[model samples]
Target chain A: MKELEDRIRRDGTIKPGNVLKVDAFLNHQCDVALFDAMGAHWAQLFAGRQIDKILTIEASGIGIACVAARHFGNVPVVFAKKTQSINLDGDQYVSSIYSFTKQREYPVIVAKRFLQAGEHVLLIDDFLAKGNALHGLIDICKHAGVIVEGIGIAIEKGFQEGGSKLRKEGYDVKSLAIVEKMDADTGNIEFATTD
Target chain B: MKELEDRIRRDGTIKPGNVLKVDAFLNHQCDVALFDAMGAHWAQLFAGRQIDKILTIEASGIGIACVAARHFGNVPVVFAKKTQSINLDGDQYVSSIYSFTKQREYPVIVAKRFLQAGEHVLLIDDFLAKGNALHGLIDICKHAGVIVEGIGIAIEKGFQEGGSKLRKEGYDVKSLAIVEKMDADTGNIEFATTD
Candidate 1:
């Protein structure tokens, strides 16, 4: 967690609209070595849980989920597709994610076959801000009668209510790095940890 | 490679239109342990090559690329975005991929900064059918002036011309499992030897 926070401080860029650009290492350009370390950390945190599958939303979450799946005993990873594709059959368990940045709700779907009843799924993602995307994944899992083991997040915006809200609900949510605040003028990223 | 071929034959569904759906293990429902083995195989094949990055297209390719990155020293993994998003910027190296399955040509973009000129890149993907997606990736690398060291594919339709064409052009393309012919009616899959 400390390493991730430090890496964010060193390389993360703060843009207007409260966006933190971590494309260099986290999402766009991935550091697989760091991800392996991240997977190890998550594996430790959620040890002893029955994680049958790794669930993540599309685009950014796919990369991290795939890497983390390696540590989770090579479980099957089912990523919810963010957009409609010919590959995605219309008969899907669909949920809407309200993207504040994009200013709309997009439908995320999963094939009925990929997710089965009574399966234990561990949700993974890059960032948890408004909790819309994570909530959407949870919805799909619920629709399939699956149990959510826990959530593994690369970064969480602590100032936002999503992380705390999920924690209050007694979900096993683990975030590698939590960003407390960021200054656009001074370009300083204040991390959440006391250290 | 033998194990992969066997798994495909057992789980892959041969549908109409020559579509071999191995979503159970290869793409949609990923077997991470198998991907680990495949990644190790790719690492061995491209050993000694100075690979600075692992480049792949999104959706299906992200799963394999993430696992393979671990074997390659956890090098950076960058995937080309298939759709326009707020996270995507204007300055991008873009290419058009004609998806015969989808019957459309969509723009695939990579952040201009993630890919740099003269970097050794290893292109990876889940399936190599027509080689159109691979060519799109290659085009992106060409636009950025990056050196493509080699390519690693999880499965190749040997009956198709994709693999042979790349090999003839002097590219070191290694497909973990190459299917000779897939019979939809009988559900038979023949694999090519590693040699």
Candidate 2:
């Protein structure tokens, strides 16, 4: 967690629309070493929780989820698809997610065969702003009758209500870095904790 | 490689359009353990190649690329984006790829900053059929002035011309499993080699 927070402080940039750009290492160009470390940290934090599967959204979350799955005893990772493909057919657990960045609502779906009933799942993602995506994942898990053991996030926007809202709901949400404040004009960023 | 081929023989379903569905382990529901093994095998195959990066496309390729990066000495994995997002801005290396399965042509873009000139990149993907996506990636790498040390594929449709074409063009293409033939009616799949 310290390493992640440190990386965020070093490489992350603040921009307009309350965006923290980390494409240099987090999203587009991924550091698998960092992801491995983060995965080990998450595995330790959620030890003995019986996480049967790791769930994430497409494109961005796939790398982190896969790397994290290594630390979770090589559990299978099932990513929710934001777009429908010909390969995806039959029964599905679908949920609508509102994107704060894209300013649009899209559907996220997972094959019902992947998330079985009574399985314990861990939700992982890159960022949590308004908890819309996380909430959508939770809804999908609920619909599939799977128990969400916890949520792991690389970075959370502390200025936003997502993290707090999930915490209030008593979800075991662990975020490596929380951006408490950001000054776009000055390019100054602050983390929630010094550690 | 044997493990991968065995898993494919067990779980892979042959369908119309030359589709060998390994979604249970390779794509939708990913087994990171198997990916780790495949990564290790790829690392050995491409040993001493001095690969600085692992290049892949979004969604399916991200997991394999991330897992494989660990074996490639924890190199950075950069996945090209199929769809543009608000976060993606500035100069980009773009290519047009035709998907035989989807029966459409779409654009794949990689941020210019990620793929540096003279960097050694290894392209990794889930499948190779018509070489459209692989060619697009090679084109992107060519535009960026990077050396593609080799290409790693989980499965290659040997019946198709993609893998053979790349080999003929002098690329170090290594596929874990190559399906020489598939009978959709009988659901029989055959790999090209015992090696």
Candidate 3:
């Protein structure tokens, strides 16, 4: 976790409007080794919990979740699709979320057969800001009747309400790096102290 | 390679209109263990190549490429984005491609900073059907002036012209499972024999 926090400090850029650009290493261009380490940290944090599958949203979370799946004993990683495709047929658990990054609302879809009742699933994502995406994934999990074992986040905006809201809702949220404050003009960033 | 072929034969579904769905393990719901095996196989096939990075598209290819990057010494995996986002700022290498599955023309975008001139890249994808997606990635690679060391494909529809055409273009293509023929009615799929 310290490694991740350090990496973010060194490589991450703080933009105006609280936009933290980590595309250099986290999302667009992935550091799989870092992802593996994050996975290991989550495995330690969520030890003793049953994680049958890893549920994440598409485009960004797929890489991190898949790499982290190795730490979770290679559990199946089901990425919820943002767009509907012809390939996505049959019964599906659908939930809609609004993405500020993309500036649009899109449906998160997972095939029904992929999620079975009573399965314990670990939710993983790159960032937790407004928690709209997490809420959508949680909604799908609810519809599928799957148990939410835990939530693993690579980076969480501590100033935002997403992480706190989820924690208050009885969800075990483990974020490796939480940005407490960031400055756009001075390019300075601060992280929340976690034990 | 045999492990991948076997898994495909077992879990892959043949739908009408020549659709071979391996979503059960490959794309939608990913089997990371199987993906690790496929990564190892590609490592063997593309051995001795100077692979500086693994380039792929978003959604499906990100997981496979990121997991496979470990076999390539944990190289950075850069996935091209299909849609424009506020997070995706600055200069980028953009190319348009038509997706048969999504039934729309989308842009494949890679940030210019992620790719450097003369860097050797290995293109990885989940499927190589008509090669539209690969072509888009290759175009972006050309714009970025990166050397494509090889192309690693999880599955290739040999009946389609994509794989053959890419091979004709003098690319070192290694497809784990090449479906030479498939029957939708009978749900039988056959792979092309390889060494």
True contacts kept of each: 0.72, 0.82, 0.98
**Of the pair 2 and 3, which is ahead by DockQ?**
3
Looking at model 3 chain B, report the run of 10 residues with the lowest lDDT sum: B186-195
Q: Write the per-residue lDDT of candidate 1 for residues B47-75, one digit (tens) a residue.
A: 89999999998878887898888888888
Residue-pair clashes per prediction, in order, are 0, 0, 0
Q: Per-residue alpha-carbon lDDT of model 2 for A5-96, expressed as tens digits?
A: 77877887778888888998999999999999999989888888999999999879999999998888899999999877778877989899
Candidate 3 residue runs with Cα over 4 Å from true position: none
Interface RMSD score of candidate 2: 1.2
Candidate number with the higher lDDT (1 or 2): 2
**Residue A95 shift from truth in candidate 1, angstroms:** 1.7
TM-score of chain B of each: 0.97, 0.97, 0.98
Tens digit of per-residue lDDT, candidate 3, span A1-195: 799999988999989999999999999999999999989999999999999999999979999999999999999999999888989999999999999999999999999999999999999999999999999999999999999999999999999999999999999999998999999999888999764
lDDT of 2 by residue, B20-91 (tens): 888899989999999999999999999889899999998899999999998888989999988777898889
Pairs in steric clash, model 1: none
For residue B13, what is the lDDT in candidate 2?
85
Error of 1 at B171 (Å): 1.9
Pick the winner on lDDT between candidates 2 and 3: 3
List, residue by residue over B57-112, the lDDT tens digit for candidate 3: 99899999999999999999999999999899999899999999999999999999
